[model samples]
Target: MEADLPHLVAFMLGTGVRIGEALAVHWHEVDLEAGTVEITHTIARVRGEGLIRKVTKSRAGERLLHLPNWALAVLRARHAAGILNDPVFADTRGGYRDPSNTRRALRTALSPVGNTARRDLGLSLRTLRRETGMTRKQVANHLNWPQNRVELVETGRIKVDHELVRTLVATYNVDLEQFHGLLAQIHDAVQPAESDKLAWIRSHALRKTTATALDQAGHTARQIADQLGQAKVSITQDIYMGRQSANPAAAQALEHAFDDPDLL
Candidate 1:
């Protein structure tokens, strides 16, 4: 991503706040000297209201976050360059950035060829959901999905088809071919742009990275939860925390199971 998006990504990476929350951040909410930013609002597009600055998604999403030095440097540079009272990451016109469009730009930057990778597909679906102003949890509850399944689908780990998209969008039986045609058009429209090496990175990935870093640094699950504005530590542990890649100890335990003398 170009221009201010890199700074925005860095801010999100440091703070672990949701994309909407990051978009809604105003200069007034930031305490540069204190190295903290209050999370009070989030930007979302309402059907008739256009872009509205609303309260945080959850009460716990309103916690204050301490900025790392690098994030603070980003804020300082922005503060020096930007007008006061505007959003910390305002659009070119100095208004809130639409999450849908931002996500599309991100996808295009990552895969400028418009190949429509599984991650892009997930992001496209995510854009659709954001357009409808529905949270992942709400969608999961509506579809009777397991708690983490929505997140997994949107992360592109699970294969998705247009049928699933139609179902999730809550549309009546219609022409699936037409939907495919429209999706193709959307893919064609994403213009490629310059991006950093973390082209595959999305905001949620940054949050998970931050959480895993905190865990490695000896922070408790609750501490990470607080930093991430998650109400439940269990959710933090289950969703944000990354699993160890090489479980050598577990492997040894498994091998030991075969060492039992008594054969059943």
Candidate 2:
């Protein structure tokens, strides 16, 4: 029971559904055909009681979301194991899950995997979701939310979009699918390719040579500098690098100057 809490919480994390939303999720809210979940209400702790139904945090909070394949698998698996109906995560008494108990269960569940915070701490699971690159707004959009609601969710002070969440995951080269498959590949395949590196350097050299030739062709150093937006010393360094090539046109143009008084 305790060992399964993180797996339960992982569903919320993967989907970016709020804890309250996850707690309140019932069979009626899901549409297997459409692959979506309708956000209606949530279960929250108001007083000293266990779980109570409450209105969603915002009007934007009440929206529909397309369920990802990964999320659906977890949901389907849990449902198939007799976790359907009134409360998706019911306690042993067959009532709503207690928030305190849920926290303890989560702590216990995360321990075997070595992937949770201190049990006695004040950290909200939402913060943990963000740290783990999961959050409500992010999950909602992946499920195809209303345009107006999606806007509010992304830029809203309270929630962030799924794309933003994906962006965060991308920074770590993580993919939610199969968890760390893509991450492992990126880590393993990220060595610098010497051939590609040399190709890029050669391209830079050609560009430098072209720029210098054009610059030496009666163009002022400042004009060339303005064109490339580089320092004059940089131009000098390119010339020093032996990138200057003899052009027949430039030599022809210079040949006339060698015999003319105006060249002086």
Candidate 3:
């Protein structure tokens, strides 16, 4: 993950910025001396419009944010060698990084983190999809499944069954050897021991973790919401900060409250 993504994921976690917002940030927007970054633009893919840079989702999202020291250091080093007009995080061609490309990069980077079998299978499927220039919907249509089903399988949310494997093999025109290799990976990933490590890790988990940490550290919900560019504190509280238990004993308390000798 470190080698493939470099500092991109870390930058997003440290700042609690959305992936699009982080990708759209330019070197000129970073103030190393002030330890601040101006949140101005975000990258979005509009239907029939392609990738476009637009103002943030809301007025609150346009506010400037103070950077953490580590985030500041990253920008400082980049500023020392990077061009002002270029994106802080650039594509291979040294232009704005597309959010889709970033997601693909993340999937590749995380391929080795846990459950090697699942990761390998997911990466292989994703690679074939990209090579064929087929969208998830296109693949789903070919396989007679919903787009989310194709997405879930590729993201490791759904297990790769034999039927899906055969469909993918036929859809992508994989040879006999490749089919066998994929089958082997699917079999390995479904082993009881490997199942425990098969959890899917989404990129948004970083943002949620950051928000939860801030909430635990006594930052106001509104403050965290602002930093995350959320239009409402309720949104941040309900979504990001809700991932963890605010009080660990709440579960025990509920158990005790519902305790009944007859039921037991």
Candidate 4:
């Protein structure tokens, strides 16, 4: 009963439900009959305070997200358990879900996919965000939420959109349109990389040291990750190591990294 975190997290990410929104979801918020989820609130806990239910982060936070077929199936499986009206994600006490526990669960679930460590997890999350590239404010705006609250829903940060689905199809060359409205029927897939990961390996020393050189060259974490075949969290670790010296083309690389979508 407590072991489905990975699938659940992947479903939430696919749905763009933000961590807080995901935790706050209730059976009532999920309209199984309509195949939608109404995001109405978020869970938060500030320093010195225990967890509390709060209005969603922004006006954009309150939204009606049409669940993808995969999301719908996951929801259906949960609903079939007959716990309607209960918090969709309850805690140890079967009360409101704890955000920390939920995050831990998500990390735990992502373990087999190389996200077990904190650095690796951060890298994975940043990779997701960069791939999406929608800002926290943009996500909030779409969700009808306050800009400030956008950060809390980091996992489910962006609102689901057709663009994402289209990207999935186009980038992966999957004939998803043939499936019509049955999005859940499609198998999970990943897009192919355009560049050679080996190129970065040949250009840099250790994968761990590449980020520092790039950072000293004034590259952003995103840029370094994109160019070095590493993740932003890994780049941050290199920067933290304090042994990085500026490399040639660091500034130029940073400036132009985003110009080429193919590089990513």
Candidate 5:
């Protein structure tokens, strides 16, 4: 999780800025005194130029965002650290962080399993979904796999390859951190399956759980959108440790919903 951009993740949740826009942020744009961060440019990968930080496409994309308290704290810490890099979120080498690598790192931080994937999606009868009271047949239907396949997976009669992992992710509707630790464990078919992380949560644990949790808490669609910086409601969900934005109700919802800090 530390290797991933937890701070940047927090900033995105608070500002609703696109990943590129967030990456392009310079020290000059972040006004901690004003509690604001301007979205002036977005980072793009040109064919030969590597990363190109350019002005936003339109005036709308160039809007200024107010920072929540927690997000401000994150910035303060960064500023106090006196990072030599121009970009607020720089790579380990103090240079522009590639969008692809950053995204991958964020996915990695998310624990795609939160370390729970080792069991949640592994061969275990006591997996997360089943422990939540979901029957094998129900899960099978969700995966569009034969019921026998679910049993096979649980019985350790078969290995869950990358395709199955992707299908499970898509079917379960979880983000990176939920499956964060899974990638390392995914290919380790020999790794013994223990308790399922999916076993812990209940009531639609998979499939838009993040957004649904926010909605149930009474956050508006717009707020959810801003929190995720996404137009789609299905995946609405961020963090300083980045701070949770109080102004936007979604930020508060996220703060309450995600148990793990990195999940934000």
Candidate 6:
């Protein structure tokens, strides 16, 4: 990352702002004099329509954020030459940047040698289901899961976990080669970008880092949660503050006990 890209990434890391919120920011929303930014809008890609400016995900997401010195400096430099209604981060055509394309750019910049195997696993699944004449409800019934679960998985709203992947593979009756190919594509799509020693860093990782740093600096969970625009402090504590346990001994013990042929 260079030029405005580094500053953009740093701004997100510093402020814990989501990429969509940051991309939707306009000069009017930023007060360089006050070192603050109002986050009221977010850019999202609607299915039929193109990228549309929408309200923040929740009321909490519409709160104001105090800019750190670095972020303030960035805004100050931009404000010197920016128009009132222009986006803080503009596209080549001087319009709002698409968050999805921004993510692709980040991936490409961090990894020059792009992964050729990358595929739209979610779209592929959706196409497969449609080709098989299966509605979301029918697929959910086959998988013994909620219809919303099928919808979310197909729409990429929910991450496809191992059990879900296995279930889909079985339901689709994919051959070995197709199964491995689909698995590879899903793995690439779901795994974070790991290039240039960034260590799987994504926009959300920066937000989590901000929350963790705040917690380490003796800030209360409620304060961190507020800064992160979370509805509850427990979410900040459990997910972003690194307070969740990661012990895998239970899984290992279960596998050992159940996988033994003698026990069976």
Clashes of 6: 0
Best by TM-score: 3
Estimate, for each residue in 43-110, the C-alpha lDDT of model 6 and write its tens digit. Answer: 99999998988997776677777766655666776666553347888886788888978875664444
Model 5's TM-score against the true structure: 0.51
Off by over 4 Å in 6: 1-3, 81-85, 112-196, 235-264
Candidate 5 worst ten-residue window by lDDT: 235-244
Kindly list the per-residue Cα lDDT of model 4 for residues 1-264, writing each as its tens digit. 474453455345334455666777888778777666777777888778778778775544565655445556667876787545456766656677676666644443332231123223233333544577666566557656655433422333222234444443343234546645324312121222222122232111233443454567576664444333222346556556432222234434333322333321
Write down the worst ten-residue block by lDDT for model 2: 113-122
Q: For residues 8-120, what per-residue lDDT tens digits would candidate 5 score against the true structure? A: 86677556567788889999988888787877888889998998899877543665666666767778988897863788888777677787777645433333332344444
> How high a TM-score does candidate 3 get?
0.62
Residue-wise C-alpha lDDT for candidate 1, range 31-134, written one tens digit per residue: 99977788889999999999999997676677777676667777898788754546888887788899877865555444332234655666766776787777
- Cα lDDT tens digits, model 2, 1-264, are 533553454345333455566667677887766656666677787767646977776543565655445555667777778766577666666667665556544433222211111111112223434676745566456555533332222222122234544554443345645445433433322333322232222213333543455455675443333322232346565455332111223322223323333311
RMSD of each: 15.1, 28.4, 11.4, 23.3, 13.6, 14.5
Ranking by TM-score: 3, 1, 6, 5, 4, 2
Candidate 4 ranges with C-alpha deviation above 4 Å: 1-3, 47-49, 112-264
Name the weakest run of 10 consecutive residues (lDDT summed) in model 1: 245-254
Off by over 4 Å in 1: 1-3, 83-85, 112-199, 235-264
Task: Kindly report which residue pairs in candidate 2 clash with one another.
Answer: 66-143, 138-162
